[model samples]
Target: MLSPSSDSPADDVIRALADVADLVVVPHTRLADLTTLRIGGRPRALVECRAAEAVTAAVGALDAAGVPVLVLGGGSNLVVAGGDLDLVVVAVRNREIDYRTVEAGGAEAGGAEAGDGDTGPGGIVVRAGAGLTWDELVADTVARGYGGLECLSGIPGSVGATPVQNVGAYGVEVAQVLHRVRWFDRATGTDEWVSPGALGLAYRTSVLKNADRAVVLEVEFRLDAAGRSEPIRYAELAGRLGVTPGERTDPAVVRRTVLELRRGKGMVLDDDDEDTWSAGSFFTNPVVREGDLPTVRSRVADRLGVEQAEQMPAFPAAAGGVKLSAGWLIERAGFSKGHPSSSSPARLSTKHTLALTNRGSATADDVIALAREVRDGVRQAFGVELHPEPVWVGCSI
Candidate 1:
């Protein structure tokens, strides 16, 4: 529990937010309990808002008071420090879902056209509250025979965070289907809906990530009405579904196959599996300049032989560079799955090299140490710098 002075600024802000409708002030809540990593310490206080207006009210008050604030969603992509922190957590808890049908060739929902071949007749738009669980929304869409979101199945976190990180899996990214985002702009104190172009969406990041620019209140995604999944661009997924790449299949089958692949890599969250207790993927695939690719391949060949280096996974990134697999790099750098032995509190996940997991007793420091070791090892071995995917608070590697 926080025991600040009577006149502390946090206390004053709490008093000011007491009357905000649908906002609850929770004291002594640990970040560990709120995050999927199951590690972290307590914030000064937690402000849980149940509605969009309430979220705006609470966050606006904190911003006005100059109180340090952390806008928490599902806590799936956070790496927070331990000990009693000085920041206040504003939790978005609005859980509304609305589906609107758009007539083909009509005005698009959020100023964006539907996917290719989706203009035949009907298109579905799903507006989900920022606080709703991500997978829950995906399951709902698949259950109704809708497509578009099946490739992103089994991802943790909230709907609001999808655009923030441009969440993607199985070759599908949120930027491909995002209709519009309703956000509360911090700088202007105005609530408005903006199209995807307003967001600087990249491989795995956006303007909203790591910046306190705005708080997402709700998100809308376009869906296919023909009950067919998005074109399978991932080779592994397509091979498993017995279809060639770029072919569309059943949404249910895609969802099931994606889930299976995720579970095998311990990407899905499960209480019984310690390996699933992580911040999903710890590192983004490193994109190297086209000219530098040869140097990296030469280094790999010198150390790991020509055959292994030739088989290294390299994909053409949208930004004109070759994206190298971080997991493959980590393994080839001598950091195997469950590296540094079974006795360490924090180590590489037993199921996946890219995930840094907590063995029930790991601290933020433990995770940071292991992350540095792997990142530095890869850098030394291949000259490619690996960047962390999760947002960091009060700590860094």
Candidate 2:
């Protein structure tokens, strides 16, 4: 007979899940090894799923037993608490990619012929496994001479997480080209493919965020096959590429420039660089209502001179609000790049004002303390709240 110790709740679930091919389960895994922050504690269990069926089977069994599941991807956009976590981590590892150009009359999901493909009036399509690194897909597409993802080239995370946050940068968002998303609906235990419209995508957010309503299995993006990039919208990118505002430049040029800019900002992941040991762009730029822009501008004018206020960076939000720079608010609020000091365990990235980084020995608490300090400080100075972009686990800001 088996020992009673051999059949605990997690073990029972794992045993039942073993029948699913390509799904592996291990107990007592540290989340610090799984997140970009490098500060989380160990989870009760870790499930590695290499295929969609394995993911569904493993998660379904865990959910049925009322086990808390934390779906982990590339771990680029997460912060988890340091200590014994009470949940199980589901790490997606499938990595498959297929390319298709839209054929005449808009073929069905599997209608297009498979090849290196091109973009044009009909558009190119890329289908990738949920576990694929986002930048890898972008690099592949651009290398093949595609252009739609140029502005978003250096972003870190999984393909599946893109639509969850409607990931955007340099004025380009995943929502603009997402065609289909295959998800395992947690609430219903159903797996299926749905159109992008079903996710209710918006600026840096979607239905999958915080709700834990579903687990994305794969993603499909439509791309420009004409070998020209989307219109250059971000001024900094345009200037670096030597293109006029709104001009369509080569995707390769845009990708290179964006990577350079991100590296300088410590937004790109660099294992050897402590400044990049962070969740890129810690705060999303705050968007104030249309009527509220003047109040903010006036505040800036009052604090710094009228000339400074006139030059403050502000843009019309896609949803009509006025988007103010979070970095600007942080700096004006007295938090400079590498705020606190180089000796502190948690400090602002010296390369960028927006990133809150871990200086090798930071506990989750250390990072949180800095985040709260920056956030509360910014609110007091500018009356604008800074919202964190990374997903927080077992902690709140």
Highest-TM-score candidate? 1
- For candidate 1, the per-residue lDDT at 141 reads 98
Error of 1 at 220 (Å): 0.6
lDDT of each: 0.91, 0.84
- Model 2 error, position 65 (Å): 1.0
Lowest-sum lDDT 10-residue window in model 2: 112-121
Candidate 2 per-residue lDDT over residues 1-397, each given as its tens digit: 1222344576688777767799887766777777777788877778899999888988888889987889989888888888777777898888899987576655634664332222234677889999999999999999999888889988988888888888999979888777788899998999988887789998778999877899999888888788789899888888888889889989998999999998888888888989988888889999999898888788888887798789889888877898889998899888998999989999999989999899899998999999999999988776788899888888977
> Which sections of candidate 1 miss by over 4 Å?
1-6, 108-121
Which residue pairs overlap in candidate 1's backbone? none
Candidate 1: residue 277 Cα off by (Å) = 0.9
TM-score for each candidate, following the candidate numbering: 0.96, 0.94
> Which residue pairs does candidate 2 place in steric collision?
119-225, 119-226, 120-225
Report the lDDT tens digits of candidate 1 across residue range 191-266.
Answer: 9888888889999999999999999999988889889899999999999999999999999999999999999999
Quote the positional error of residue 145 for candidate 2 in Å: 1.2
